[model samples]
Target: MTTVTEAVPPAPAKHRDQVATSLPPARGQSFLKLVTLELRKSVDTRSGRVLIAAILLLAVAAVGWQLTHLPRGTINFDGFLAAATSGPVMILPVIGVMAMTSEWTQRTALTTFTLSPRRIRVQLAKFVSAIVLGAVVTTGVVVLALAGTALGGATSGRATSYAGMGGEIAAGYLTVALNVVMAAAFGAVIAQTAVAILVFYIAPTAWRLAGPELFKDNANWLDVFGALGRIAERDLHGMLPETLTAIGVWIVLPTLVGLWASSRREVK
Candidate 1:
């Protein structure tokens, strides 16, 4: 007897058992993910690789260059460090610009902000990550600097006081960190990397120049890099208050403005 057979429909998958889980990611986790991705890209890329190498190579090269220009007996370790480090400071800001600009150029920020929807969180992550990256790079520079010093046949230690060292390292890292934060913030404000980079390049110079000339003594309060230099040197040059003000303007103002802009802008 040919019996009619009933077709059975497939059962619905359990929530936990679904091959593709439907659980939403935690909010903070998404921000962390963004930071990790940025750092990873930086570490993996040829350009990022070149950054550290270039710093080291430049330090050594500066020592070589100094040998040619400096008097025979003037080739001291401290002098070598000053010469090597001076040129590299300009490069750090460029790095800050690149960090933010690359995101838009590569379209990575779209995916990043889309996932979290909390722009501040993403900004904070980038800021923190940039500080860490800068610290690591600076540490590498310091190592290379020490090596260069040793190669120069000098045995004296760092000239700055312990207190000075503390302040110097803190200020140096903070300066680089603030630059990164400014870039990230500016990126959000402008949304175009090219425009942001141009502003970053010009804004501080204008501020420093116009500040001192226009404001007189008040200019020291407004001079961004000059204040940073004082803080880094721990010179107790009565610029501490001004340096604090500059830090507030650079680090906090840009961050607030950026976050506001990011919150308002349409996600492209």
Candidate 2:
């Protein structure tokens, strides 16, 4: 007699397929999270605290000194903005460098890269955060400086127009924002905060003091710092093309290189 064999059940192949098809990290859990996380990390550290305090102090001092020492005339609040921005400009690159280099210096690069998987995203997040931070700080300072100048001018019976200062102050902030981006790019390219700071600090001073005789002919196009100084004058004066090009070179190129490098390098 032939015995009927029980039918064997088939495995759930569709369930396996569905598991395979499931997407990676949700769309909401991307770049912005990484940036916010990074910013938080930065704010929690002593170094970060010191750096921020220094920047604020410098801003306050620069404005205070200018208001007190500026030759009595129109009480140029715009001019004070220009002076105040100089401090932030000098520090912007250093801040960028610190943001990038700190990952390595603080031994967080490995964790950051591993979690993100896309190293470039991490680098870009740092960059965007730095730019935003710089712009916020610079703009806030400009507003404060204007208010302080207005109060002093009003009490002293001096001629200071907040309306007139608006354009110049805006230009000063724009300059600071641009420089912040450029500095972050440089830090990314260099992968070292110290070097980026040195380069950022020295390049402008050196160029102004020892530039070639033809410097005047090409200064409008080649000098990043000079562009800021010129722009602070608030006329544009046909310098936008040159300023844009210089920004691309000094900031964009380096940032791209750094992103590529960060993507390729082995996290430590």
Candidate 3:
């Protein structure tokens, strides 16, 4: 009789388990990296580039016009800062809205959600990018204001007080940043660029116009425009409560709603 061949041995169950478990740890994108990507995306489009250029042009024109029209001694740093920032502040919110709505408007939501999966991170990245943009614009305003101030002083031989102007300027820029964020939140919730922009501008204006008649005793706390006006005036100490309430309503509430909508919306 022929001898039977030896049977082959199987791998140990523990060894199999070890092989299955041996995978590289999962790596996700960092917040800073996401912010950088978002910032690049904001300006990569043609519309974004045009908006930025237009903002710069408008800022320069505003400053130039003020210098030409206002009396030489009157063109102080504070006034110059306000004039320089007005154009950017008015339009920067539109940029924020575009950033938030571009994914849906451009039909890239599918790819974006697929790559990131967690939508909150994407929204947060957009928010951070908006803040960064606001800061950049604020810096530009500051530089322009300084230059204008120096020129006015040289031309008119007058010196203006720089005492409390710093705090006021900072508060004004911070309010602008907050407004950009609020617009982005609205954009995220609506997911439509035109609708979001319309609502962002119209709602505040309507509220400001009707708030006193409608809300009466509570307009100060309920009206975003009034609260932010106080903020722009640097009345932080006196109006802190009202400011917080307004921010909670306008920025915080919309942001929460946006996060909810973004998380649940189907990606097609």
Clashes of 3: 0
Candidate 3 clashes between residue pairs 3 or more apart in a chain or in different chains:
none
lDDT of 1 by residue, 112-194 (tens): 67776676776666666666777677666655555655555443332321223344556666666666666666665676767
**What's the C-alpha lDDT at position 132 in model 3?**
89
Q: Which candidate has the highest TM-score of all?
A: 3
User: After aligning candidate 1 to the native by TM-score, how far in Å is the CA of 249 from where it should be?
Assistant: 1.9
Q: Best to worst by lDDT, what's the order?
A: 3, 2, 1
TM-score ranking from best candidate downward: 3, 2, 1
Return the lDDT, model 2, position 225.
68
Candidate with better TM-score, 1 vs 2: 2
Report the backbone clash tally of model 2. Answer: 0
Give each prediction's root-mean-square deviation over alpha carbons.
4.6, 5.3, 4.2
Residues 1-268 of candidate 2: C-alpha lDDT, one tens digit per residue: 9999999887689977888789574564467898888788767889877877788788888877776775667776666676676676676556667777788766788887767777777888888777667776677677767766776687678888555765665676667767777777767766667776787678766765665455866665666666666666776578789877666766677778888877776676
Mind sharing the TM-score for model 1? 0.77
What TM-score would every model get versus the actual structure? 0.77, 0.79, 0.87
